[model samples]
Target: MKSLTNEVLHYTLFVMILETIEQYYTWALIAILLLNFSQRKIPNSQKKRFATIYLAALLLIFEVGVVTILTRGWPQKLAFLDLAICAALFYFFREKAWPFRFHCVNCNEKLDMNHIIGHDDNLCQKCYYEAHPEEAAKEEEKNKKLEPEQSSETLGLQDIPDTVSEIDWDIWEPREVCVITYLFENDQVLLIDKKRGLGTGLVNAPGGHIELDETAKEAAIREFKEETELDITDPIMAGRLDFQFKDSLSERAYVFFAHTYRGTPKETEEARPFWCPVSEIPYEKMWEDDQYWLPLALEGKKFEGRFIFDDQKMLDKSITVEEEDNE
Candidate 1:
């Protein structure tokens, strides 16, 4: 009776251990499936087929373990049946099941593993560049314009510069980084009449200098709220402005566009808030650069502009609008 009781306890412990392992395996498989499905870079059909095979294999392994535990020994016939089913599944879905491609789809060139897994197009680097000539050109241009390692010395000039070409932007550092946010609602945009500071009395978007350790986006949100008492949401970066002011103030401002906001716009000590129709922006009353780039921004375009400013008057300017990629 004692020997029989010990044997029963041993089987019970084995069953518990098997159940614990099965639970862990099930959870791990679920996590892998979720990760696979969430991946946007991989093809959907490939992800689904891989998930199916993985699930089937996991279920088969669990079934074999369960059968072995229940029968007090490994079920040889059941194990063999599971193997055969896996083999059949692999045979039927070989192309879909295989994740690695040995050749470029475009040029039939031999590809490394990085090309097979890293690229959704299954093309090698050379073939990829050939297929995307514009992207190749952009890459080459970017490589040619590498930033210099040394920073430029302060100009310390007694006279304010009159031309944008006087400053080398590659090594030029800004004294202050600022951010501006334009809130759009329907056909109107929120604008502020500056009451104090640099552009006092000029019409502009709500903006201020970035505080220490704060990101440009965070600073934009804070400045908008402080000036207009409104909480803006989903602020999308639209452009950047590099200002070389004659007053020895070098500023780089990141511009953002927000369409959603909460709270009402109220006048503050720093600015007076108002809603102006998109078609009727008072450009003459605002900074001169606004007339050139604000229109493009309203049309959902990205731009970068460099300006040499003498107080509120712009001396020289260069604006570049980025080409939109519809793809």
Candidate 2:
């Protein structure tokens, strides 16, 4: 599985490199045409392409222009290559450009990107206004203003779909390293009943973000001590859970879980640690995704997956999957 994953990564990296080269060519060609070098037989389709690439290159250069396009080699070629890349990036992102075509994520159809350019991405821009008329009104107000587009309101507009049949690939996900420990005593497992914040009034495993200057295991131990005021010995490193969620407020969320906790249980305001039979877990009250995968982890399973949601901290639709357990 590791070898297969690496092979896939290598293939993806190679394709990206090839795409970059192609983009450079497209940009240079567009640049030459945009400058209108005399006596060039540029076709109408070519002109349309040039319009896309020229704009793309201009936008890309405006972004990466200052850092000296040159690397260790000759500066001139590097500059030219940079310009070409910008052009390709622009063309590659044509779905987001003007004369927009929004495709429905559920059912492919041209969406009105102009109508709900900000609020709608997963839905076809065309159908969003119809499916969500109220949201459409808000979108209309936004469009009428000719707003200069708020950066924080939307992070990856370039990745959103203007058409009805595409996916918004630019889901922002920054990775973090953390630990998970399943506190245990006899047959019962230790768990935390969260008392505050988003997942309040629910049961959870007793652990927090792995602290700084510490390994995941060390951080888990320290967090247990701080949150529960209990000393644990020999906390084992269980498996991990990779979780994600998205909503109107934020682009996405990622969380990890561990099940190898030790020591006696204690209660705290932040989280009440207790030992409960694994089978009797209140899975329904827990976050929507927990029931689907938590049990697998408790029984010692390693997993990774993407889950969609209507809100950041809450899960709406979850897809729990595992790599082939051939090993």
Candidate 3:
């Protein structure tokens, strides 16, 4: 009985539906044309899309309202509810019922209303690795060997993605750089809270980006002053760490420690500088490979490192600790 009622109602609505739809179509076309005529700063694609949606919503409301007005000859039973429901549906569809967007990790392409399979980094046949089989083979072999053969324990960290959020894997570009300055005092290595993007809420060395129009040493001094709020009088550059992470959004860090400085360390939004015993640190909360290479720096030793992380966020990573070529 319910099915019969639905079928009869559907046929009745279907006949009048075209006329109802036409009314809405007219309103939509006019609205979008007017929007284009206005010429706003909004991007062309966004402008057209927003205009279409706005028109569609108006169409729905007008169609339902007119249908009730025509059939009942005026507002009557269920007319208000029908109009309200149409408006509510338009709101819901516009705000919440949109399709999920898939982004290409390598190319940063966003696709709307489509599932792009095999488009991501190595998930499909047309992936970059497939185009370069030799490189892909080598990569797989190296990845297999990266893990320790003897024990389940791995030599380097495996949280690749989070560790290398700053690098462009397909292309090398140094957008942002950092300098980690460690102060050796009374058998304690000073560690500071990051107070910035990656490890903002986490503990890290007191350092920051090497800005333009400033020498690296000068940048280091400025960063130390800004973060630690301690003015270093004689911060002779000991060495540097070139942390290379394999990611699109991750950055290579140039870490430098100073043995000599002036003023007392204080707390700031960037970091609260304090001395930690060289033997103990909250390694779990730091850059995944901090402990492996930081010790060399703390021992008054100079070295550069090449660390790779899969993701652009977090410190989980794999590291190749080596001495710097320049040093």
Candidate 2: 10-residue stretch with minimal lDDT: 247-256
* TM-score result, candidate 2: 0.41
Model 2, clash count?
A: 22
Ranking by TM-score: 1, 3, 2
Q: Residues 1-327, candidate 1: write the lDDT tens digits.
A: 999999888767766766675567667667656655444354423544464456556556655655565466653345456557767766676666555568988668998745554455678888776444334334433443463232222455564468888667775656666888999999999999999998998999999977755656777889999999999987887888888877677777888899999999999999999999999999999999999998888887889899988788899999999876676
> Residues 1-327, candidate 3, lDDT per residue (tens digit)?
999999878656754654566467676767656644443433223434454456556666766566656665552434556658766776676543232236544444564322231122312223444333323334433554563242112223432234343333343323355566666677777788676666666778777766545655566678888888776544544443434443433344556566667788888887878888878888877876676777666665655455554443334434444444573
Better of 1 and 2 by lDDT: 1
Worst 10 residues of 3 by lDDT: 114-123
Runs off by more than 4 Å, candidate 3 = 1-171, 236-247, 310-327
State each candidate's clash count.
0, 22, 15
TM-scores, all models, native as reference: 0.57, 0.41, 0.42
State how far residue 213 of model 3 sits from its true place (Å).
1.0
In model 2, state the lDDT of residue 49. 39
What TM-score does prediction 3 earn? 0.42
